[model samples]
Target chain A: MFVLASASKARQKLLDQIALRHKVIVSDFDETQLQEPDPILKVKLLAKGKADSALKKLIEENHALNTYQALLGCDSLFEFKGEIFEKPINKEQLISRWKRMSGQSGFLHTGHYLISLDNSKSDMESISQNNSCEGVVSTKIEFMNLSNFEINKYASTSEPYNCAGGFAIEGNGGLFIKKIDGCFSNVIGLSLPWLKNNLEKYGLSRLLLDR
Target chain B: MFVLASASKARQKLLDQIALRHKVIVSDFDETQLQEPDPILKVKLLAKGKADSALKKLIEENHALNTYQALLGCDSLFEFKGEIFEKPINKEQLISRWKRMSGQSGFLHTGHYLISLDNSKSDMESISQNNSCEGVVSTKIEFMNLSNFEINKYASTSEPYNCAGGFAIEGNGGLFIKKIDGCFSNVIGLSLPWLKNNLEKYGLSRLLLDR
Candidate 1:
């Protein structure tokens, strides 16, 4: 089994898609603790911090970490017009963002940090990036042009407010996207190919087949 | 409301994604009747035939298709190594195909046929391609190299046998795909953006907003 260090249902579904059994352990890391301007770097930092925070919690609880082979943390941010976007702040912001995003293209960057706990370390705090697998997967998305009426109508639905960049590709927003030009799974939340490669490259193929 | 003239659950889910109310009517067209060798043309013909057959059934049953504004038919085929692939014939075929397709790139084409019924004619038979909206959407898919064990294990599951290319992108196959470079929804079954454009451009914008 593996540990997922996030509260996102979308990320959890991604693991289910690949038949990976995982335990959801929400990280206590405050997302607002970082004010990084770079989208890629910000997501990577958040992903690592989330995993680290979860690890700290596991150790504190005296949890038997041996049951789990790996822990994965993920964070997604939409980069549009050189701005970082997570979930829209409010209805007005979501509507306004949709208006501006119409007929435009953006990049969705999802950072994945996977911690393999096979290596025994008496000093848990000694764990560092020296032996971690991580990456920032990005996908380009284009939105179809929308009129004011269309925008208002879609914004009236509750779907747009909860997703990054004010849209959910797998939900109602699927109709609005004109195209995507990269790893499609990254736009949803996790990059499956990236995860599969890391699982194999990090000597964790057991996770791939043991399911 | 619209009439979905196909039996694909994936296509039905695409309509649900956009909150479009649809009445699903299975077409009676015999798929084996099509001997078309060209992948693009074959899908287009199949899509149109499915829609036509459904329309004929509706008229025969004296069904009130007037309640529906449009009818959509969809067909998907995978083009790999200049060969058309629908579903793998059997486990051996699937394994062999996977072995040959490992680490290879191919195209997934989904043909969309939309028939607008608002501007109807006295004779339904008079309707021609000139008045209909259709297109074949294609997406490039790259597969990751798989060992023999991986192929055999994936084939053991019922997932790969039913998909067009011996893989389900939205299922366990999601891990096997390295990247895709086109309309993501098309790979699933329907092209949402293409449908959105046809709805708006062909003066069927009501389908988009009234949904």
Candidate 2:
């Protein structure tokens, strides 16, 4: 059994693409509490936090799921010239964010964590032995030279507010992207290839082979 | 005016995503004669061929509407390792292709061309001065580990043969992809972000300014 620690539709859709049977659990952890300069590291840390939170919640719920089952967590950040762009809370902020990103290149970092819960309650066991690995995949995006009118109109779509960096490359914000230098799926909120590669390291092939 | 030089449904759907007003023209170009080993250059050359062929046909048929319009053409290629994968012609080849790429990483390259047509014959004298550009965008995709049963089930859906890589990442093939390393649009047979940027050089935006 696989557990996904996220509420993002994009992430869910990415998993669906792989035909992976997984359950979604929204992480209740507060992301704003983390203080980090590097957006990539921040996302990775957040993903780990979400995984830990989810693992605890699942154990407390008395679910029959094996604690040793694979748990997946993900987080994303938009970085432009070393500045992290968080999710916009309002239309005006989204418009301003788009205006700032117009004609500029930015990086979207999506960090993923695969944690295998240890059913055995042993204090001496190493965490690495319990099987946890993390990685961050970054995608570079170039924004089209957008006019204020275009930016305002796109913001009106309300697609930007909930997305990091005030844009959803898979949604209406796609019109503002000029080019992408790295993984496009990362900007869409997940890097599917990276996820598969990481999952393979966690014995995904063996799991499927046994099944 | 934007004129699309192909009748592909996938291309049309992609254009619709940005709400770009475009007229489709079927280019009766001889694609068989232009086969080459270099996949990137081949796609670009094919796109250019389509654009030129459509431009000529439009000029001969609708002389009144043949002024200062930008012609857009696109082509896609699926490459695994160093080998280029074309659309499968038979069920056996399709099955073989899927078996090879079922759980592997592959590259999808989409080449785009924008050719600005001259209205007057006198202006055609300076055809070199007309704004024209070409670019190739690549996206990397990784497929999940698939069973023989899964491969046969998906191949039965008849979605593999029509796509360049024998898979449609946005459709039933999505269930096979584990992750994507490059642009999702490129894998979907077009790169809207790249198109938007290339169009910007012609003072055009994919998003309507007044929308």
* Displacement of the residue A165 alpha carbon in candidate 2, Å: 1.4
lDDT of 2 by residue, B1-211 (tens): 6788988788877777677767899999898999699999999998888877887777768857554457787888898888988888888888888788876888898888777653444454234236678889987787777778767777776677788988886665654676566556778777877777676666665333223
Question: Tens-digit lDDT track for model 1 on B78-170?
Answer: 999899999889999988899999999999999989887766754765553555788999999999888898898898999887789888898
Highest DockQ against the true fold, candidate: 1
lDDT of 2 by residue, A33-123 (tens): 9999989889999998898787777766755655346788889989988999888888877777778888888889888888765354443
- Per-residue alpha-carbon lDDT of candidate 1 for residues A1-211, written as tens digits (9 for 90 to 100): 7889998888898888888999898999999979999999999999999988987787787567677778889999999989998998888888888888999999999999998876555566655355477899999999989888888888888777767888888888888888899898899999999998888877887677455
TM-score of chain B of 2: 0.91
Report the poorest 10 consecutive residues by lDDT, candidate 1 chain A.
Answer: A122-131
Q: Which stretches of candidate 1 lie over 4 Å from their true place?
A: A119-121, A128-131, A209-211, B119-121, B127-131, B209-211
lDDT of 2 at B46: 88
Using lDDT as the measure, the top candidate is 1
Residue range with the least summed lDDT across 10 consecutive positions in model 2 chain A? A120-129
Kindly report the root-mean-square deviation of model 1 from the true structure over all alpha carbons: 1.9
